[model samples]
Each structure stands twice: as C-alpha cells, then as structure tokens.
Target: MSDKPYQDKAVIVTGASSGIGRALALRLADQGAWITLAARDAARLAVLAEECRQRGGKAIAVPTGVTGEAQCKALIERAVAEFGRLDVLINNAGIGATGLLEELPDLTLFKRVMDVNFYGVVYCTYYAVKHLKQTQGRIVNISSLGGKSPLPYNSNYNASKYAVHGFSDSVRMELAQAGVSVTLICPYWVVTEFHERLMDKDGTPRGPQGRAIYSEKTMTADQCAATTLKAAARRKREVLMGPGWLTVWLRIIAPGLVDKITIEMVLKPLVRRAEKTQSKE
Candidate 1:
C-alpha cells in the first residue's frame, strides 16, 4: 500500500451535494483523488466539483438521482470515461422517515425510502462492479446504526439500511475472489442534514424545523468522512462507529433486554413528543 493510497484514484461519491457525501468528496480531493460528484442538485454538484479541483483533485459533476437504473449505469460510465478507470464507488445516497409503520398514511413512504436507500445502492453497485473489478477497487456503503438494531418510529429507514447491510455483506463475499473490496460503514448519529431529509408521519419531509431527538455526543460529517476513508483504504469488512456498537452486541447476547432498553431510552420519548405535537396540531 502507498502512503497516499487515494492519490490519482478515480472515485465516485453519490449524494455529493451535502453532508457526509460532500465531506467525503472534499477529503478525497485533498488526497489527490479524481472525484465524480453525483447528486440531484446540479448546482451544488458543480460547486463541489470546483472545490475539489481547487483542492488539487480532478472532478466532474454528474447530476444524478440514484433511484433509476439507467441513470446509475450512466453515472458509472461517465466516471470511467472521464477518469480512464474506476477505483472507488461510494454509495452514500439515502433517505429516512420517522413514525410507527401503522401511523404512515400510505405505503409510499416505505417504497420511497427503499427505492433511494436500498435500490439506489443496488443499481449503482450492479453497474460499477465490473469496472471496480478491472481496477481491483473498493465499494463503500454508508449505512446507519439503526440498521443493526430495532428503532421505533423508523421501520422504513431501518428496513432500508437492513437491506443494505445484508446486500453489502453478501456482495463483499462474492467480490473477495476478484480483489474488489466492500466496506460497510455503520455510523452513529452524526451532525448532518439527515434530520432535514427525515420524513414525518404524514409522508412529508420533516425539513429543518422537524423535532428530532439528538444526542449531545455526535460526530460531525467531516469526522465521519475521515473515519470512513480510513476504513475503505484498509479494505475492512465492516465497521461500527461510536457507542452505538453496544446495541449491536447487546442485541446478540440479550435481544430482549436490548429491545426493552431501546424502547425506554429512545422510543418512548419520541412517541411522547409526537403525541404532544399532534395534540397541538
């Protein structure tokens, strides 16, 4: 391995408009990586591309919504065409919803979350796998701690990440023989725009004003990006970031106990607040 492992590498970062994806792009750029910035926001992607260039990495903005298979294929093709090869693919695009499954107005919330979070990863990886094989590259999936354990009011989000967890793990085994590495990143609550994108019970985006229970102990997007980059560089199989790993272990040793703890420590407060907010409305 080289001291500057990412130097001159061709990397594609989905959801590059903001949050963890944006942070990852900038950090990769600083490492001299050729970055392909993909997001729904063309304006933001273009701006980020320029910033990457200023940091010494070549970059291209490929405006994309990962929900469509054709778009994902095109994204992979564009990155390979521009950079001559694909060294890394980061599946960081995701969305979330907050509410009990029974509370949602329709199943659209579940479908939408699955489409963006699970299918988006599937589409991008399916397209990029062959290219990555040629370069013996890396695939990084950004998941959540909620994926590993049950969290009330996040059934849709949890299901999506759970799908990602299983898919990524299975794919990693399949790609092991080809020298292509897959890394699953399960990070705890991070200070990002995720809360803004979180949907409420009525199938509407929560926006910035949405009331979310956040822990004072949180990691910044930059911190998450740095940690993820390190894990990907090392070709780690899976990593659990922050204290959230406890739930994963406890779930294994004492599933019922963990469930009770989760309900008491996290779910009850959320349900209480949701009820209060509803009463006012």
Candidate 2:
C-alpha cells in the first residue's frame, strides 16, 4: 500500500463549520494531519475543532469569510504559523443562489454568488499556492456536477462552478511541472445545510420552490467528504460523485441531446409546477 499523503502534513479547509467541510476536516484529522478550519461561524468551528481533537488529530479553528482577500491571506498565515508548513489547501467554501436570470432584480445577487463561489476559491488559491509550491502540495477544489452540466433556475450557481472547473483545469496544467497537483471534486446534490444557508443579497432564501427536488437526490455530506479525501490523496485530477454521472457523461458525448432531455424532462415539469403553485396562491 502507498503511504498516506496526509501523514505529518498541515492542511487547511475552508467552509469548515458544517457540511462537507466539517466532514473533510474530521477525516483529515483522523489521518494524523494538522488541520486548520476556516469559516465564518466561530461557535460551530470551535465545536468542530474540539471534535477533531477528540478524534486524536490536531486542529485549529479560525473563523474566516473567504469572500475577502485579506481574510483569506490571514487564514493561510495562521495555518503556516501554527504548523510551520502547509501541504494541502481545500477550497470548499461555496454558496448557491437560484432564480431565473430574468427574475433576478439586479446584478447584486449574481455578483454575491460569484464572489463567494468563484472569488472565494480564487482568493484562497492566491494565498495557498505559494505555500503549496514550496511543499509541492495539493489543491482540491469542491466544484459541482452543475459546473459541467447546466441546471434549470440555477444559472448563477452554474456559472460560478463552471468558472471553477475552467480555472482548476488551467492551473492544474501550469502546476504540473512544479510537482503540485490540483484536483477537482464535482459532486451532485449532497444532503447538507447548504440550502438553509443559501441566500440572496437581502438574506432571503434563494430557491424555496426547488427544495423537494434537492432533497430527492441528496447524498450525505460524509459520503461526499470521504470520496473527496480519497481522490485528493490519490492525486486524481477529477472525481465526480453521486448518481448523476450518467447524465454528465451523456452531456459530454452529446451536449444538445442532454440539453434537450434536461429541458424537456426536468425543467419543463418544474416550471409548470411552479406556475401552478403561483396560480393557486
């Protein structure tokens, strides 16, 4: 068996307060890596850190908002100061906003979604790349299947993830000679508190109409996290999770065919139902 890549390494995970981030933190901690947990919720992060310690792994919680560059830099600095070296950076912090592009009132909602989902990854990567290059480390970006295949009523969310896929691909090519590997984890509908936290600029829930659909295909956060860690350790380029791979592959083979099926089978039904619900109200 190959040696565990996480052993004796210092790792950082953003969005570590809950969901996949929390699970990834605990998983890495269990593997004997020193973990730095970054998220906006201090209380939740503290609790997660304690749990990591209980699991016999070193963990430090640093409440962070990945939307800003300074905070992203601080997160990296704190991790390096605590562990003296950084080996992995997991850009897992993200948010989703849903609405028909025409229905969104202004550009504000779109910008906010892009800021967190796209710029957050950019900021974290900007800071983490230097340390990673030094260690010939790894970067695992938490993209989504939506990144590869567009979904209905979530145009903004899909755009951000698509950007992630492109950016990761480009960087992965550049980092190849440096011995640093970049991996993208594309997951489909994981069961997490993500929707609860998803919001528009005014802090209203983004997609109440689609909650039932989300619940149907959702995998547990732990399952996603475990798969992500395994892929990262193996230094794989891309790992697509969930039962949606068939659709994704179909899209790869025939974009127009997949688009027609999605629009006809999924989007039309959803739009019709939404219209009926509105008429009833």
Candidate 3:
C-alpha cells in the first residue's frame, strides 16, 4: 500500500489475535506479506488467519504463549518451516495491572509483567535474531509511551516498558552492524481491550476509575498499526505516537519537574478516584 514493495515477504506478529497485533498483521497482509499469526487464543488467531487469507494473503495461525521460551522457539520454527524465511518480527503481546507498590504482593505482579513484556520480547528476539541475521530483516517492538515516562498506579507496566527501551536500544546497536534493524513503537492510550484486562493485586478487574486524562484523544488500532508499519519500513530507531510525545520530551528536558507534575496532576487524582469507585462498588 505504501509502494515500498513488501510483496511475498515473511513476517511474524505475536499477539496477533486482537488489538494492535491484529491490525498490524492485517496491514502486512495487505502489503502481500506471508504472515505467521501467534497468540495464546487459538480460536481468535484462526479467525484472524481466515481474514488475512480472505484478503488474498498467505497466513497461518500458530497458537503461542510467548511467556514460555519453548513456545517462543516453536513459533519461530513454525514460521520458518511455513515461510522458509523470516523478514520481520513484531513483539506485541503484553499484559497490564494497576496498583501501588505496597498494594502489590512483593514482586509477583512485577515479575508477571516483565515475564510477558520484557522476557517474552527477549525470547522472541533470541529466536528471531538467528533467522533475521540470515535475512538481514527487522524487529519492531510494540512498546507503550509508559516506557518512556513513568505513570503512577502503573509502575509495573512502566518498569517493564523502560526495560524494553533499554533492551531494544542495546539490540539495535548490536544488530546494526549485521544489517538487522530494530524499531520501537511507542503508543499512548489507544482504545483497545487492554483496559478491560487490567487487573488489581487480587486479579480483580480495575474498572473505569475516573475520567481518563486522554479520554478524548484515543487513537484507533488501525491508525497505530499503520504508523508502526511505516516506522518499520523507514527503519526508524523509535516512533512516538499520540499526544504523549510532549510528555516524553518533558521527561528528558526536566525529569524532576515532569515527575512532580505527573504525580500531582495525574497519579494522585487517578488513585483517589479509583479508591472512591472501588468503595462504591
């Protein structure tokens, strides 16, 4: 669609059953890429694969739980076996939780968040690197704006994303010489099922706490997917999407000021509202 010539290329999209992952997979399919859709939801993956094929693209659904190393390895193996080569790997699968550090039980929530967000990216990158080195391909990691700027009540999520920024930057340096590119996509508050899945310390849903700060600025999954693919095509080191760009820049220019502002303007208010909502419920 971009006239950039992606026909017949092979791509692997993790968490491809829904949301941003699904949007990316379909976009690549439109570019005539052979897609390997990986997700834990086999049924949803199957439906997505069918949709891709219906659009006249080659696609296969591979059920994968990227939190496990073996599953990540199997996913790459299946992609290679099916497509013979891998051109791109989109590390998009992730989960989120909300609570204070003290509210969480030790590092359980932190570990779980990192396992899927950071470790899962690591596992997929490890396997994909071997193939990508051979093809001189690309890796696009779906990171959140939270990775660049800290967000209260979502410390675990922010930490995981920060780890991703560090990891991706290191890999990009290591792979630059090999002609294997790495791109990080940082998006802010896209309207997705992510909120519905957000959990508390007891694994209970964290429903709408208060009026969202960026409630009116929600970007669609398709818009995010398109921006991500464009970034990949350009081989950009980083792409910041949505209105969160200013916040990320502020963090770089004046960390303490932004930190104080974020705490005062966003975190405390949101926490109080959440507590009030929980009390009512």
- Report every candidate's CA lDDT: 0.92, 0.87, 0.88
The digit string of per-residue lDDT tens for model 3 on 1-281 reads: 35744578899999898889999888888878899999999999999999998876799999999899999999999999999999999999988887888877678778989999999999999989989999889999999998887788888899999999999999999999899999999998786677767778666764664224336567888999989988888889999877677987788899999889888998899789769978999
Off by over 4 Å in 1: 210-216
Q: Please give the clash total of every predicted structure, in order.
A: 0, 0, 0
Error of 2 at 196 (Å): 2.9
Q: Which of 1 and 3 is the better model by TM-score?
A: 1
lDDT for each residue of candidate 2 in 1-281, tens digit (9 for 90 to 100): 34555868899999999889999988887888899999999999999999998987899999999989999999999999999999999999998876567767888889888998899999999888889999999999999988888898788899999999999999999899988999999998787778766664344774554355565547888889989988988899998776567878788899998788888998888678757856997
| Model 1 lowest lDDT segment of ten | 208-217
TM-score of 1: 0.96
Highest TM-score: give the candidate number: 1
lDDT of 1 by residue, 102-171 (tens): 8778898799999999999999999999999999999999999978886888999999999999999899
Q: Rank the models by lDDT, top first.
A: 1, 3, 2
Worst 10 residues of 2 by lDDT: 206-215
Comparing 2 with 3 on TM-score, the higher-scoring candidate is 3
Candidate 3: misplaced stretches above 4 Å? 1-4, 207-216
TM-score result, candidate 2: 0.92
Which residue pairs overlap in candidate 1's backbone? none
